[model samples]
Target: MTSRPLRVMECAAGTPGFGAQTGLMAEQNKNIETWRRRLTFRSWHRGTKELDLLFGPFADARLADYDAPALAQYEDLLMAPDPDVYGWIVGFEPPDPAYDTLVLRDVIAFQRTRHA
Candidate 1:
């Protein structure tokens, strides 16, 4: 049995392997920023004014603080129909099991605190 040495690559700027590693990192960051911007815009423009008001402010206040999983949850919530999502958030109706998430709870809490 032969043991091969593990190569630890330095990805810092101006270091070896920097260009490729940093380029990938930069691309990932750009994609995340693009998704965040798109979600924020969508939140502010949900067909009805009610939804716009409910989600727009939430997106603005919290989107930047969300990690990858949280961001994915938000993106899933946005994919739902506005009326359904709004109903769930406002407690007018129950969310489907899949739509029920911490992200939705956070939104509900946000709206409650924001309007209270």
Candidate 2:
């Protein structure tokens, strides 16, 4: 006998399996929100107050708009040593080529706008 094609059902709200999908989506959103909050806290609490001032406002104004790749880039920026990152932002030193990214440029631009 010939094999039959498999059919998949799309689950919309109020339909069977929809609640489970909704619950999973809600859980994923909650986890992302928590991660964002933690990043915001880190941005605001970097050891130096100057770094805090630099990152805190950028995180506050832009963090929520980041999708997964942007979030990953921001997280990577956060993981870099503070002095180096600050130096890059203020043009005292060039950012390591590997770490030079749109996210960093955005932060530098944000800082410029804030102080301009």
lDDT of 1 by residue, 7-93 (tens): 434325466665464566688888888889999999999788998999999999999988778999998998898778978999999
The C-alpha stretches of model 2 lying farther than 4 A from their native spots are: 1-21
What TM-score would you give candidate 1 relative to the actual structure? Answer: 0.79
Across 11-38, the per-residue lDDT of candidate 2 in tens digits comes to: 2645666545466677888888888999
Off by over 4 Å in 1: 1-21
Model 2 Cα RMSD, Å? 4.7
Residue 85 in model 2: lDDT = 94
Give the per-residue Cα lDDT of candidate 2 at 3. Answer: 75
lDDT of every model, 2 decimals: 0.87, 0.87
Looking at model 2, the pairs that clash are none
For TM-score, the strongest prediction is 2
For every model shown, the clashing-pair count is 0, 0
